[model samples]
Target: MSAPGRRIDVCNGDADGLCAVVQWRQIDPAPAELVTGLKRDIELLRRVHARPGDDILVCDLSMQRNLPELLRLLDEGARVRYFDHHAAGEVPRHPGLRAHLDFSPSTCSSLLVDRFLGGRRRAWALVGAYGDNLSDVADALARGDGIDAHRRAQLRRLGEAVNYNAYGEDERDVLIPPAELYRVMVRHQDPLHMLQREHVIGRIDALRTADLDQALSLGPWREHARARIWRLPDAAWSRRVGGSLANLLAGQCPALAHAVLRDTAAGPLVASVRAPLRAPRGTHELCRRFGGAGRAGAGGIDALAPGDLAAFVEALEAGDWG
Candidate 1:
């Protein structure tokens, strides 16, 4: 009898992706090769070299971006399972592939896994949801579980810190690589327990605090009646704080759309765009026009030409966010 082929788990390095895989492994306790990268590294499906009959699990990546590679994997006779909440342009029908995908703005990959697992490890899912910036959804779920506000706050903090650590130009900008962080995360089933026992969570929180302090000193570069934009210099700290700053500004001024632009050395701008909390539509539409992709509430542009910044800001200011 031949040995079974290897099982490979590929996911995004952010908290939602990491937590989804964590829940699955904790439930099955199976051995699998983990494939992950920094938050900006979404083209992870191409990294796997699985043979026929191997098991491949993917989470939290856009199928639209990975369609060709995914087709290659399926054609190579590998059995694959995919879970995501991103914009998947087209889904192929194949007996070897099982996909659990939802693109709703209020849903995330972790929440999908939570539904699959019937909430067996709900706390972990909550952490993932929180990491994805689904605060109200995660909080409502936590409330149903009878968790107090204090513990809920801890979970939110832990989630934010975990998600925050995923940013950076490369692994060098982060305190620890995300795959290594996942190794530590899978050890604890409860997120709060991880916070209590692991020093890494505290370390992440401290670093996030320092990064935020630096970012808070900067004022908006462009402010209009309906939108605002902040520009950060080309630095590791700027890359690390761009997304978090967008979220912070969205929460602080829920009436105005916010854009956090990080000046990149590559002569383009990397941007994080958040629609107003009161009206979280049109952001995905906005980013897609700039060769970026995300959900309605939050989206990002990998690269925006310097000359196009004026037009992008104008679009935000004039958009009908409903």
Candidate 2:
């Protein structure tokens, strides 16, 4: 006995996650409530409260992070359908759980959803790959589908725009919320159509690029093999530019790990770090020093007090890659 009519969809508010749900709903069209937040809000299943006989769809979040909440939901009688490319520590066998989990470099939740939906939404799949920075993978797939290089570039740009929009400190820093963007996007069948017509994509790209320019204008940390840190003044612009800063630093100095540290509201500094893209390592471990966490390649700190800035800088300047 599966639940009917009581449906809830929850996913990370990034392009990959939302597009994953888009593919799913296209395959199984139904009206359901959506629970979503920012790109950093991947642990959203914890926020959902539902009774037994409810059908919940979750995507693009770590099952390991959501384990406790997932168990609670199942115990409360909610059946779950989960799709993800993140790590899932261990899963319990239960009749009520349906998981479509894949952890692969070329895959995102949207691509997985497209696969599950029998490739009915391949266009969005390209978008997800672009968002996830899987350019080689995205380019190859688009070519396989006989997409023109120009169209492949368009999808890549759309992917970058969509991915860029998901960044920022929180909801206030974004141009538009992911849920609202999803609403606008779901009206179209092909994302390539979006590439041609949607102004939101251009706005997002322009905003992100402008912010990146500002960050680059701030100059470099001028350090050696140690971590490179750029201190950002507290501003709405800084908040919006955080992700782009990390990316810029990563590309500008591929051999060194980078951190973009910005002042927050309460006098503490927030930081986003990226390991060497070509040799990504130790970022997660390094961020742990400031009470943040992420995977091997990227991570951040929630807050670092004023006194800690110098120490943090010293640590960054002395970052040991050896």
Candidate 3:
């Protein structure tokens, strides 16, 4: 008798990705090998090694970035399930692949998972939506589910903290590794219960607050009628705060697109871009032109050269995000 193949779960390490996987695992509760990494580590599927008959589950990672590896896995005879809300260039047809992809700016991987599970784990889904900066969407869902104002607020905070923790150049820049955080998060069926019982969430939230305060104190490097850009020095705090800072700035100025660029020790800059909240679109298109990729509402560049800064700003100023 041959042994059964392994169950491998691959996802991005951000709040949306983690929460999506949490919802699935909570319902299934089967043992699986988790392959995840920091926020910038979008190409996580390359790490997966699946054999024939293996069951592979993917969430939140961009299909465009992982398509080659995914095709290889499918050819190896693995059965794969994928869920995401990213700009997938073209989805290939495969008998072994079951894809649930939505590129809508308002939806995210967690919400897609929620729809699949029929909202059996709705609270975790809310955490993911909030973390992805879909506050209005999350709020409405929570309210419809009869979740009170206070609980909704708590869920938002938890989502933000978990999402914030996924930033940073690497694990050392973060307060906790995302995989370890996932171990902490998956223990509780209700996220509110985890918030009440675990001190880790509070610790992460406190650090996020401090870092954000420091970032907010800095003035914008460039400001325009339609956009604002902030540049942060190469520092641990800056590395950890860039993505969350961009999200906050976008919320504060719904009419203006926001970009946060932080200097890295390796010479190139890391950038996080958010489309105007009033009209969220075209971010992925912009980033793709610069050799980066993301969904329409949010995108990032892993290592933007200094020489391209002027051109990037020019494109930002000229973009019709709507």
Question: What TM-score, over all chains together, does every model reach?
Answer: 0.97, 0.85, 0.99
List ranges where model 1 is wrong by over 4 Å: none
State the C-alpha lDDT per candidate: 0.90, 0.77, 0.94
Residue 243 alpha-carbon offset, candidate 2, angstroms: 1.7
Q: Each prediction's Cα RMSD? A: 1.1, 3.1, 0.8
Ranking by TM-score: 3, 1, 2
For candidate 1, write residues 1-322 as lDDT tens digits: 7668889999999889999999999998889999999877888988987788999989898888889999999998899999999888879999999999987778899999999999998999999989888898999999999999999999889888888989999998998899999999998988889999999889989999999989889888989999989999999888898888888889899899999999987899999999888887888789899888887788889999999988898898998888
Return the TM-score for candidate 2, rounded to 2 decimals.
Answer: 0.85
Highest TM-score model number: 3
**Over 4 Å off in model 3, which ranges?**
none
Clashes in each model (backbone N, CA, C under 3 Å)? Answer: 0, 0, 0
Better of 2 and 3 by TM-score: 3
Compare the candidates by lDDT and give the number of the best one: 3
TM-score of 3: 0.99
Locate the minimum summed-lDDT window of 10 residues in model 3.
1-10
Error of 3 at 129 (Å): 0.4
